[model samples]
Target: MRRILAVLLIAATTASAAAAGQSGKPRYFVKAWLQKADKTFEHTTSWCGPDQHCLVPIGEDMIELRELSGSSYYLRFISASSEDTPCCVFRNGSREARLESEYPRVATLYYRPEIWGGRGVTKFGRLIIVVEDLY
Candidate 1:
């Protein structure tokens, strides 16, 4: 009877610890460039994947995306040239990528958020900026 109680206590402790770990995880977001060749696509902020590429104009307001999780994200790009040409790009990660094999590019940009969670106060209001090539 004592042994069973001990085991139950251990299991409860373990479960609580796991839940705490998950809650402690900081929320994340990615800022990436939707288009490669467009100079107007260059910008920076908290709205991109850690491994994704970023393209923005030389001088423009930097727009960012926030609240990204589980290796997947929703990408919406407002065309710098045409307001009527806004595009929505759904970028996902490796884990979520397996869900859709047809569009390989739709996979998430960052694989591990813990490794690339970025710096500063990530919980309340934080932003991580990364620049790369999407090729």
Candidate 2:
């Protein structure tokens, strides 16, 4: 039937994409930047405080991210298995780098109005300026 054909088509595409990538651990990254409430984009962490105008100052360990978390500047990566979906690192507020892959499929991005765009954070204090795809 049409449904079966469609399912086969999708599986074929995914297999093709997986094979195209290099022989290594499958991984991806997300990029974003930190913006002060003063409307200025701060590439590096500065005098940002947790309960002040800036919550993430320079050298602050951004362990907690949108969907990823770890120690200091680097995050942990978990490989995918046949029974589980692939994992990704949400590299938020990183303006210099972007996430890319040779694979044809990828994760979809969306805006979180209730979190950063709500009141504090970017609207009133500080925020991690992540693009739609980075979040």
| Local lDDT at 112 for model 1 | 30
Inter-residue clash pairs, candidate 2: 32-93, 32-94, 33-93, 45-58, 46-58, 49-54, 49-55
TM-score of 2: 0.22
Q: Candidate 1, which ten residues in sequence have the lowest lDDT sum?
A: 120-129
Each candidate structure's TM-score, on Cα atoms with residue i matched to residue i, is: 0.26, 0.22
Highest-scoring model, lDDT: 1
Task: Report the lDDT of model 1 for residue 97.
Answer: 20
lDDT of 2 by residue, 1-135 (tens): 535533433343332223323233322222223333356432221121122111222122231222322111222222222323222223342222232222121222222234444443222223232111211
Give candidate 2 misplaced runs (Cα > 4 Å): 1-26, 44-63, 66-135
Report lDDT (CA) for all predictions: 0.27, 0.27
**Candidate 2: residue 68 Cα off by (Å):** 5.9
